[model samples]
Target chain A: MKKNFKLVIEYDGTNYAGWQRQNNAITVQKILEEVLEKLTGRNINVIGCSRTDSGVHARGFICNFVTETTIPPSKIKYAINNLLPNDIVILDSSEVPINFHSRYNCIKKTYTYTILNREEPAAINRNYVYHFKRPLDIDLMKKGSEFLIGTHEFDSFRKIGSSVKTTTRTIYSIDIEKQEYYIKFNITGNGFLYNMVRIIVGTLLDVGVGKMTPESVKEILLAKDRSKAGMSLPAQGLCLEKIYY
Target chain B: MKKNFKLVIEYDGTNYAGWQRQNNAITVQKILEEVLEKLTGRNINVIGCSRTDSGVHARGFICNFVTETTIPPSKIKYAINNLLPNDIVILDSSEVPINFHSRYNCIKKTYTYTILNREEPAAINRNYVYHFKRPLDIDLMKKGSEFLIGTHEFDSFRKIGSSVKTTTRTIYSIDIEKQEYYIKFNITGNGFLYNMVRIIVGTLLDVGVGKMTPESVKEILLAKDRSKAGMSLPAQGLCLEKIYY
Candidate 1:
């Protein structure tokens, strides 16, 4: 029987090349494919909601896969997780409709970026967080978020190879909080371009450091020039918080 | 200058064979000794407060080394950390008298054991926590802490190769707290025999699981026989919190 399965995955993406499959490097897709093929003796295609960059980590990222195998959806999670590396695990799995694509039918996606701001360097979470020695202005960063809201041409925020045809997307909300040594940036959006969230974070950081004005983000958006934006933030700080479908 | 220097170190301990220097396997002491030999031109002897077992991690385990290199105490921490692996870090360093020993001068040591109590296994913290299938009674675990406190000869909770002449130790405190998916055991003592703290935690888990009464721990301590105590818990759940001198 043809079936669609939705899976909630958690991964420490430091060891992997990225979420996508590649020839010379380790990837989450290749790991999942190997487990599925080994279990069912058939080639299985796993589609992930986001192609998170190398060094990025995820606590709850959604993905869907289709197969003609008669194995129960409940059994699939256990069977696959048993073979996965210690860095990746399936948190939840269940049957879904045939057309339920984790990427296409999504209503909103939330992403979080954690920064360790302190004098001493971060040791334990070095692979999962970006350590910035300088302090960031939260109020100024909040002002920058307002410019990113609503549908507009986000060419400054999108990477060069982002396959999406249009750069217009709605950011539902942006919440920033600093707890202890961690500064968390949680943003919700209807859709995001490749490296969009990370790029936004980088530009906002520039604003926080007094390098760029909060209003300059609007100019960058209107100018549709990538050169006007801040450099791409390190991928280790980013995480796919949740995907709504 | 046969100078004595103290080190407060943190290590993941998964890839390490143990804290002691061995022939083929990688160990924390081996790494530290190599770094010291290169930084200071002497074949230095290093001593750790606890010779932690394989896969047993530490947050602030203490160690001391003697060298004739004449490097300042302030520079030792930064210099050694530069050569250490990502899993290992020197939190701080200080100059101490030649008579000071990390083990002999220690007043108290604390350890924490984390249990991820849930049906699903963990991915993010696979190396840092033990996964359990059932929910634990937090109150029962807290009540069980009382039975393990105070001065006691814990022979039943010790390992076979313990070199200590006596099994007597004073437990300063036992704290149990339940977080979202983790039950944490925090224990402080003047000194612990080999595998003593892990065995005590395992016994308390049995009480939490309804296999033994909470008060039974007192009897096990008084028994003074190795066969009467609970099994040693896994190394991953344990973390050496601090060693006070």
Candidate 2:
């Protein structure tokens, strides 16, 4: 009998070359497929909900695959997790409908970016956050984020050379919070273009640091030019937080 | 003119061979001294407050060194931080009296040991915490820790074959708190023997898992034999948190 297994994964992407499989680099997808092949004695094809960039982490990533192994679905997580490295963990596994596709069936996705807004750089969490030395105005950043709350053509907030069927996307929310010296941005959207979230965060950071006005973000979005947007932030600060099916 | 400078440092000890300088191993002291030598163009010796084991982290580690350089104390941190690796950071630097020393002037110290008590081990914080699969009884651990408070001879908790001037130490308090799946043991004491904190945490874990009763900790202390105590936990879970002068 053929069974479709959905897996909830958590990974520290510091050492991986992103979610996609590549011939010259180690990736999360390749590692997962190898582990599954070892466990089931067959070649495996795993589909990830998002193609997280190199050095971007994930706490609640979703993926799926089909297998004909006799191992129970409930036991698959434990078996594969033991064989995987310490940086990637299979949090949960369940049998799903055969037609289920992790990427095509995803309804919403959430991502978070963290900045260590302090004078000194962090040592313990150096690989997990972006260290920004200047003081930021949270109010201005929040005001600027409001312009990104609804549907908009996000060409200005995407990678310059990236292409997609449509540049329009719906942003459900953008919540910014600060605790002590750490600032976190939580964003939920139906879809995001290449480097979209990082570019958005960079634009908001510019607003916070008085480099750009809060209302200027509206103009930047309307311009639809990647050069008019803020600099794209580093990938280490971004994390795939959740995906709603 | 010779001036003494005190530094507050933070380090992720995942890649070093402990705090002391050794001929065959890379250590924190060696790195800091090398950085200082590069900055000041002279041989420098740094004295640390504690001799942490390999893979042990620190957030507020104190150290002191005397130098004749003309750089301001406030600028030293920024200058050295730029040259040090990302895993080590100098958080603060200030001029201290010539007679002041980081080790001799320290009056109290705080260390924290973190355990991830859950079915699945952590992926993101794999290097910073000990992943224990068994569910721990926080209440039982707290009860057992009470026997270790106040002044006592901690010979049983020290590492076997490790010699110290005195086995007597004063533990001010041991606070155990569980947030989500992480159980943190914060211990404040006047001094700690070699591997004392790790051994004490291991003994408490034994009490938490019903392997030993809370009352048995008293017997272990009274026995003053290393074999009477529980196992010494791994070094990664222990961190030097603070030093009070």
Which candidate's DockQ is highest?
2
lDDT of 1: 0.86
lDDT tens string, model 2, A1-245?
99999999999999999999988999999999999999999999999998998999998999999989888998899999999999999988999999999999998999999999989999987888999998999999999999999999999999988879999999999999998889999999999999999999999989999999999999999999999999999989999999999
Query: If you assessed candidate 1 against the hidden native complex, which CAPRI class would it receive?
Result: acceptable
Q: Check candidate 2 and list the clashing pairs.
A: none
lDDT of 1 by residue, B53-167 (tens): 9998998889998777767897788899888888898878999999999988989999999898887887777888988876677778778779778998888899877788888
For each candidate, the alpha-carbon lDDT, in order, equals 0.86, 0.94
List model 1 lDDT by residue over A1-245, tens digit each.
88999899999888888888998988999999999899888898999988888888888888888887777887778888899987998988899999999888889989998888865566566777887877789999999889888878788898887677788888988899998779999999998888888889889899989999999988988888888998888998998888887
List runs of model 2 lying over 4 Å from the truth. Answer: none
Provide the lowest-lDDT 10-residue window in model 1 chain A.
Answer: A118-127
